[model samples]
Target chain A: MAPYETDDSTRAEDADDLRAGPRRSARYVVPVAVVGVAAATIGLVPALADSGNPDLPKITAQQLIEKIAKSDVQQMSGTVKITTDLGLPNLGGLQNSMASAAPRGGSGSSADPSSKLMELASGTHTVRVATDGQDRQKLSLVESAAEYSLIHDGKDVWGYDSASDQVFHSTAAQDGGKRHDPAPATPKDFADQALKAAGDTTSVTVGGTAQVAGRDAYKLVVKPKQSGSTVGAVTIAVDAKTGMPLKFTLTPASGGAAVVDAGFTKISYARPAASTFRFTPPKGAKVTEEKDGAHGDHRHPKGAGPSSHGLLPGMPGEKGAKGGRKVIGKGWNSIAVLDTGSKGGTPSASGAKGLGGMLGSLGDPVSGKFGKGTVFSTRLINALMMNDGKIYVGAVTKDALVKAADTGH
Target chain B: MSRADPETEGTARTARPAADTGPVTEPAGAGRAPSPLRTLGLLRSELSTTFRRWRTLALLAVLAAVPVLVGIAVRIQTGDGQQSGRGGGGGPAFLTQVTHNGLFLVFTALAATLPFFLPLAVGVVAGDAVAGEANAGTLRYLLVAPAGRTRLLVVKYATTTAFCLVATLVVALSALAVGALLFPLGDLMTISGTRITFADGLGRALLIALAVAVSLTGLAALGLFVSTLTNSGVAAMATTVGLLITVQITDQLPQLHAIQPYLFPHYWLSFADLMRDPVYWDDLVKNLQLQALYAAVFGSAAWARFTTKDVTA
Candidate 1:
């Protein structure tokens, strides 16, 4: 309501100033905008660079296998150490243990379940068990180091090494004193393959990963279709990131059955240098050189598994619980645990009748040894807690294992 | 010769001091204590001026980027399994190749040993330091100031050191950044076959940085000495670079193995030896002592020559 008045000159000047304001700001505004755009562009350089490489290098299991197949490798060998978390087939009910538990009967059973049997990890061990189903007279292979391997054959036993010039036949003959071989693979192969088997990726699952030589591992489970074999079902743990297998375990179908497992420690992916693979026979070591191809013959018997699958042969028995402490054997002290009863509720062959039933019974022709106490004849690989209460007996066979139940000779 | 400042270092900078005519006169009613050791202050100003020199700043920036380039090279070359160490006999540990830094290739194990890349670069940058000023004719102008010749040398050396530290820091930080971005900042598998976690690796890297500084001090001093020896900036640079290269080459030959221990860069990377599980200290101490001795000798020689020599140039 005041004077709606303005001097024409002043109005014109005010209008002119308004027009000039934007023009003046445009100079700085455009430049600032350009600078901001430039800064943003510079910021995007890393992003652009990353986008150019959309696929991160992803190495997978298939790729690993392919690489292995493609590698120009000649041969590989080294010192391999194996640690087992699982026990034997007859000892299926045994727990995954750092050490074995005590026996049960005066026979070979222990009074203390927490006490241990002979630990496989006692010392340096290298064993070779091989098989080839051929000549019954072929020398059975029992050497510790595996060169003539039969693991890939996927069978139970092998022939002898008697005629093979590759290794000495004396030790081979002493092992196989019998004229026949068992099946495709033998004990020598198992001992050797066990270490390598531990590194095979059998199955994969998401689980607690372990550090095998500082590499992350993924769990693998491999189960066999049947039993009576060194490997009924192997559960393996592999490195998820590296696709390298780390640990392997063989579990029997029955709980408390034998559990054989192998764990690798301080593994390295490096191949040995050229000189490492070459080996020259040392002085006095008995070996017959075959002029040709990996010379040897191995055979196996018709059986569920290898002949040496259960235990060593030629053993003595029937010593009471408190007796038989002397380690009179070729390979130092040995202890063997056997399964008398079956988890399937059936009796195994050569079944030693339950001790409780024979406590009072007189000597029966078929059932009882009639208070029979025989001097342990073979090696000391078996023992049990008896009615007499003691530790290991020097029983080397299943019968000897039963004989170890009584110590009151 | 000018009077020595007992308060500061006896041998300061790479130039000669003025003739010792008299002592500092307690100025008229000078009550304020000579401004709390202007060493750090003048050092700061010298740095600002050095950076203002486009040539110096560009050279420094390029040198800083060398590590990143090295990282790129490494990213391109590694394989599935280590090939260098493993073969028919020797195992995988033998196959480990050197790290990706190209400067390392030229310098031998210096990168692995002392992490000396930064220091070497620093010496080159700093060697022509005073000579550059002399060529610019700014040396006399600065000497005539009330601060004095010895003070000017101190300032120059201070500036050179600052540049050395900055340049080394730049390269190290850039290397760390590039390593972080380009490679996994996880555990390191040490050449000695030990596994080091990221934290441990980081600690080792920092120690390497310190070792690099120690190693570079000798070179920086040597450069300053060379700079003092001549008024030509190029000659000073060539002399320092030539010395660095010669010592590096000799360190590699097996026949020179015995004599290698005497070379400065020979122990340049002795810092890496610190990565051992228990950390071997004897070699590290020796390396530090030798480097310090080099710095002292070069520094003293430069001072002695500068004080007596005529500046006809």
Candidate 2:
């Protein structure tokens, strides 16, 4: 006990002496300073990367639109990152349930180009895109341990899924070169869509100059004039020198964050190697050759079941609605109403029952002048599926969808 | 000092001579920095001591067995002819391809173990690096042996890093061997669906293994920093493992996506990008940069803590 007391007193004295030495304290200060510097650097880097919005020549929105329209700098390759947060419930779990509910050997479930497109509707995805011209382009959706590549070389279009080792091949004449449905939505695609949406219903103005993919660009902000539209604004960063859309962002009216943001992280305008567009089905891969105009049929091998249409199983007003689809309004406030023929008690009415059940779980039941139905709402789009087999879908609020449904009915 | 009295008395018989000898041999230059050659020798000794432990061998054995177990399981599953229509099904990445080409087993096993097992093993080794020496009362002796604190810390870190490489290689080589034995090896189908020769595949596998080892270096430094904060080896190990799991969980949460990129484990799976035909280097570069940041930050922190730390233990 005496020895322990003496040892405790000595340890206290030693600690005091150690603390008293300024040089010893300085030794400790080095690490603390290192940590401080590291923290500062970590915090500083991203801020610095985004710090100075590059100064560039100002251009009007009209000139920018004309420039994008006339820009023909085709031969290029780049990496695009797309992030979409529609405030939907975990779509991964929902996709699993839908896949399970889909029938075995169902074309709508998996291994199809449309199913791959459905994967891009949520979360973040990295896409590698190379375009030699209109007829020769390659887009690869880069997954963690797999890739889904859609290569369009002249007349031949090939879609390859590495994980499944499946190849989907089609000719340009057969599918009108539109079989690249699995390709991720690039900034150019979104920018084109947003530009088309610009009209009397939208106010297009040049916002500011910024840097995107290390290229100075001018921001073209497009805001819908209608109050019912769910979209707050669409901002496209057009490369100042080339007029190429380097970034596209779509924010919701009640946005905390953009619902859809896609931009090139790296870009090169140089012509891609010819080999980039060439694709051959690897050995052991199952190759499916799509016939003329049969892409729709091939995608929905199990007949024209209503649920088997669109990128998702039950998404309304997509392809295959054909003649029954009608636009209820123009521009941003427009709603598409699809007559699914379920109300007439057609033989294929039971086909949508499975999809209806799934939608029932995802959507909330609502009643209006159009009668009882389910309303599925996302951050930027609201879809109201009527009990009478009508689907009202638009980038609008739930009230707008309900109102559109009532008026159309 | 009173603390020195007990330490001297406790190890008095042996420690007195060692303490006296350090000054007697280099009387005028006792405080001078250790030569690089001496530091190299100390590093060699530290590596030998660490690898000689039965626990390290057991951890390595467990890591080696992971690939064997994975390969055998895959072999049995496919042998039953039940593998049809199972492509792209949910499992470890590259797992479904293992049956087609044996080389894929290396990738599958690494992916399966990387998220947890490999890092867990590293955490154990690095967590015990300094604290274990202190717990065994060898830290005071090592320091008094005139092994400067900075030099000892550097050696300890290097040894832990060596363990990381060894553990990762054990898993890779074992996987390669098992993969060769259980399945046919041939042209490898990359993530881009392009075929590369077996040699190229093997080269990529080696690169992937190296990337995985480099990934754990960050965690090793982190564990070493935690070790310097405590004298209890078990406490340090538990704390490191706990931090690893917490960070992993945080990385998974969608709400924390803003900060996930800064976490060590966030980009661990980016090694798979190497399997791409064109080889996407974006995420891989981010991972390497993040790891280097962690190493520099934590390595300096460990050095500082160890240098000024009281050697009461």
Q: Which candidate should be chosen as best, given lDDT against the real structure?
A: 2
Q: Which regions of candidate 2 fall more than 4 Å away from where they truly are? A: A1-31, A90-92, A100-109, A164-166, A171-184, A286-322, A341-374, B1-34, B80-85
DockQ per candidate, 2 decimals:
0.02, 0.33
lDDT of candidate 2 over B204-294, digit per residue (tens): 9999999999999999999999999999999999999999999999999989999999999989999999998778998899999889888
Q: After superposition, how far is residue A391 of candidate 1 from its true place, in Å?
A: 56
**Which 10 successive residues of model 2 chain A have the least lDDT summed?**
A311-320
Poorly placed runs, candidate 1 (over 4 Å): A1-409, B1-35, B78-120, B253-258
Over A1-409, each residue of candidate 1 has an lDDT whose tens digit, in order, gives 0121332222222233344555433333433554465457547975664342122244454443333234332222222233333321232222222112111211111111111112232222322221122211111111211112111112112211111112222122333333322221222223223323222222223333445434555444333222222233445455445454445544544444334444443444443333221122212212332222212221211111111222221111211111213323221112323233322111111122222233223222221232432222111122332322222333234343344333223
Error of 1 at B256 (Å): 4.5
In candidate 2 chain B, where is summed lDDT lowest over 10 consecutive residues? Answer: B1-10
What's the number of clashes in each of the models?
90, 0
Predicted structure 2: clash tally: 0
Residue A180, model 2, lDDT? 40
Per-residue error for B6 in candidate 1, Å, reads 9.5
